[model samples]
Target: MTEQPPPATRTQAQRTAATQAKVLDATVDALVELGYAGTTTQEVNRRAGVSRGALLHHFPTREALVVAAVSHLVDRRLVELLTRPRTGHEDIEIIVEAFSGPLFDAALELWVAARTDHGLREAMIPLEQRVTDALAAGCADLFGDRYTPAELELTVELARGLAVSRILRTADADRALVTRLLPVWKELLDRHD
Candidate 1:
């Protein structure tokens, strides 16, 4: 039989999507490593190995790029949380670790910046709402029929509080402390269940 033709090259749309994804990933990395103030388009371009023109074509402004990046990050994290294997015996430590990791740090940076920057805040509101919806969905998926909607919402809120406290440095999130306090939080959640 005659050999099949080689696979068609990537279309321009595919290439554009790939480049946009790279820039968005680089933006997340910069936010995590350098905080909001330091995550400039120039830095993202360098990290993503894409030209400034490409970035501009994909995202016309820094705020637009950052908003897209945060949305992308939150979507990815929600997927991870929803799909992660659960032992049905998870503790506060595990939950905290899950919520207070690199993604949280990057999101925290954006949140803090949004608090003061009107443009950023405007951009972030919809993204934050999407994240909230995803978390609600994730909680329902995780707990299933064991808990009511209100209970599931409370569980998500409790975990978010613990994670936020750690990110904000208002609470001691050390393993020892988390271990000691986990059971108490679980008991509280059990009451809701």
Candidate 2:
């Protein structure tokens, strides 16, 4: 009989990175499911199925973990936006889809929590600015010839408002409503052309 090969072992750095990624994924899930006040280290540990010692070793504090998770999320989002293939989609469609997702839900949770928590507010400003700046840059690049800068800004604001409305929406119907409204919004932009 042929001998089976031994399983590949992960390096120390790789193990640490895997642990950190698990923790951050749990952190974002907690924020989206339970909001800021509900996302405790214990909860993250529970969700990640990692031991307390491991959790503490990776993230010594709840604030540190939250900020790191948000930073990680923002970095991922920026990469996605900048690297996405140009498919000639409408500006409103791209912008709306960007703002409507689990990350947006997690971010909204942080935004609400940050409004009251001074430390979180301090950490979130730069992150929020980065997202806003990326959105603006993406809009300019995608639709600069067709839409004015002011118009793009308006669309962004409107998309944000629409995304925020998702927080209290009734799910399927509201989603359909938002989808239908996208074309209506694009038509308004077309009117200016």
Candidate 3:
């Protein structure tokens, strides 16, 4: 076989992008294990096997890296929420059902991290608003003229509360009780009248 030229090295930009991604991923893993307050840029750099200078070169500040990691995590969850199958239920019920399971777990985890981490609050508020807006838009589509602005806001809040409750009470709450109470979610939409 003829000898081939050596493979070209990755470009500087490509290497930088890869390193940043590694840093972001490592940050997320650290956050998941230790929460936002516990994760540090140094720890992320160590986990990513990149130099501290390389991480700061890409992110410039710890806040920048933390925001990037939060955005990265939310983007993945948003993709899942967007792609999930809709069962064609009423808007409020759909909202309840949509935010269940791992999606809810992730939100709770992120919120808990945000509570203690100032950098996380700066990162999460806008991301969370976007998710709420997307869900509200979907609700508008489902409910059409029947759903008013105030009700939509309440539904969204209720969904968040329910998700939080689920996360907080998962251990003690009875699954059957939750299943039976699911129907009561529609009362809020009905009250919108």
Total clashing pairs in model 2: 0
Report the C-alpha lDDT of model 3 over 4-60, residue by residue, as the tens digit.
Answer: 999999998998778878988888777667655667887897899998888888888
TM-scores across all candidates?
0.84, 0.83, 0.71
lDDT accuracy of residue 116 in candidate 2? 86
lDDT of 3: 0.71
Sliding window of 10 residues with minimal summed lDDT for model 3: 99-108
Among the numbered candidates, top lDDT falls to 2
Clashing pairs in 3: none
Off by over 4 Å in 1: 1-8, 86-98, 167-173
Clash number by candidate, in order: 0, 0, 0
Per-residue lDDT of model 2, residues 1-193, tens digit only: 9999999999999999999999999999999889889999999999998999999998887777898897788778767876888777646777887786668888888888888888888888887788778888877787777987788888888888888987777889777988789879989988987
- Model 1: lDDT to the true structure: 0.78
lDDT (CA) for every model shown?
A: 0.78, 0.84, 0.71
